[model samples]
Target: MLGRLNHVGVATPSIDDAVARYRDVLGATQIGEAFDLPAQGVRVCFVDTPNSQIELLEPLGPESPIAKFLEKNPLGGQHHVCFEVPDIHAAKAELEGKGVRILGEPRIGAHGTPVIFAHPRDMGGMLTEFMETPREGAH
Candidate 1:
């Protein structure tokens, strides 16, 4: 159902500082910036590395899922593990068929990708997001 670990989402209150720290100081390459979902209220920037990317997430509004997470945790850190999937809808169906609790339906994600999330309770207390990269010619 899931392919490779696509990226790791890290919640941070200050995305600017995080980008600088990871790119300038740590020497990671800057890939690009993106907004995951308006409903989710998250703006993310990617820091490229040899193997993967560092996804820096900042809440766009107080009601954002990340904001609520920050309110309780206070300390910003790794939030979720994103897995690359061949087909998001199929993956969601497979997971749901296996009794995994899905948070929402597959929707257009950052960079026009298709994605969905699974509840933490269904993933051994860890929030998991599944993403399907758009085909080269399709939006």
Candidate 2:
């Protein structure tokens, strides 16, 4: 089962611009440095919030998934919502039993936790990510 709302993923044409909006306009003070996840084909930066976080995702390359999303809506928009889970494998099995389509095998996510994505069609047109919560004291 899901534990908490982990983060909301936002596809953006530029992470810098997104960060500027969150900081200058929204008055957000806790923002993480941008980093590349080449394997995931995205450059991400996190805007920390009281309850959850916002993940700004920019295309890392022409073939990146975000690139296609940006092409559809040049301004970019919400991509997915991630939820925390105590055990990712258990969650995957439970969702699979319910006939949900899992995007792929659980893999190391941006948070350094095991994570998996569920197909949007199975989730009310919203792509969902399930991330195992990191153990206390672990970065």
Candidate 3:
């Protein structure tokens, strides 16, 4: 089962611009440095919030998934919401039993944790990600 809200993924044309807004306009100070996940085809940065995090996602290449999202919403918007899970495999099995369509196998996510995505249609038109939370100080 899901644990907590891990983060909200936002598709953006530029991470720099999103960081600027979070920093200057929202007064966020605990922003993490932007880094590229070439395997995932995304440039990512995390803005820490009290309860969760805001994941800024930008296309890493022309074939990046976020590129298609940006094309649909030129200004960008919420792409997905990640929820923490104690055991990813268990969660996957449970969801599978319920007939939910998973996007792919659990893989290493930007946070260096095991993560898997559920199809949007299966999740009420919203793509959902389940992340296995790392142990304390593991990250």
Candidate 4:
């Protein structure tokens, strides 16, 4: 049911510093950065690698999901695993139809792509994100 691992979400207090560290230490290059869906309260920076991507997530507010996660988890580390789907909206709907609770509705994610989150409880306590490249000519 899961698609390709799109990127690994890493919660960080300083996205620029994190991006620099990754670049200087691992030779990863920053691909892009964006702040989207203010309702979700996160600013993200994406770094490209040969096999995968590193997503640096910065919480926009204390009530943001990342903030809550940081309060209960480690200071900074992997947050969620994202799966690249052909159709995120459809996939989210399907999961909901099967009684899966969605964390948020579809919206433009930090990567400038359409994305949605599925509640961890529905997936064995693992937070999941479904993402898809916007269709051609789509905004």
User: In model 4, where is the ten-residue run with the lowest total lDDT?
Assistant: 29-38
lDDT of 4 by residue, 1-139 (tens): 6777878998887787787788788887656764544767887777877777888888888878788777776567889889888888789888899999987679877656888988889878888888885567853
Q: Pull out the clashing pairs in model 2.
A: none
TM-score of each: 0.89, 0.97, 0.98, 0.82
For residue 10, what is the lDDT in candidate 1?
92
Model 4, residue 88: displacement in angstroms? 2.4
Q: What is the lDDT of residue 60 in candidate 4?
A: 85
RMSD of 2: 0.8
Ranking by lDDT: 2, 3, 1, 4
Error of 2 at 14 (Å): 0.6
On residues 1-139, what C-alpha lDDT tens digit does candidate 2 reach at each position? 6589999999999999999999999999999999998889999999999889999999999999999999998999999999999999999999999999999899998999999999999999999999999999975
- The lDDT of each candidate is 0.81, 0.94, 0.93, 0.79
Alpha-carbon error at 63 in model 2, in Å? 0.9
For model 3, the superposed segments whose C-alpha errors exceed 4 Å read: none
lDDT of 1 by residue, 1-139 (tens): 5587878989998888887788777987656765556756998877767776677888888989899888977767889988888888889889999999998788876647888999999899889989996578963
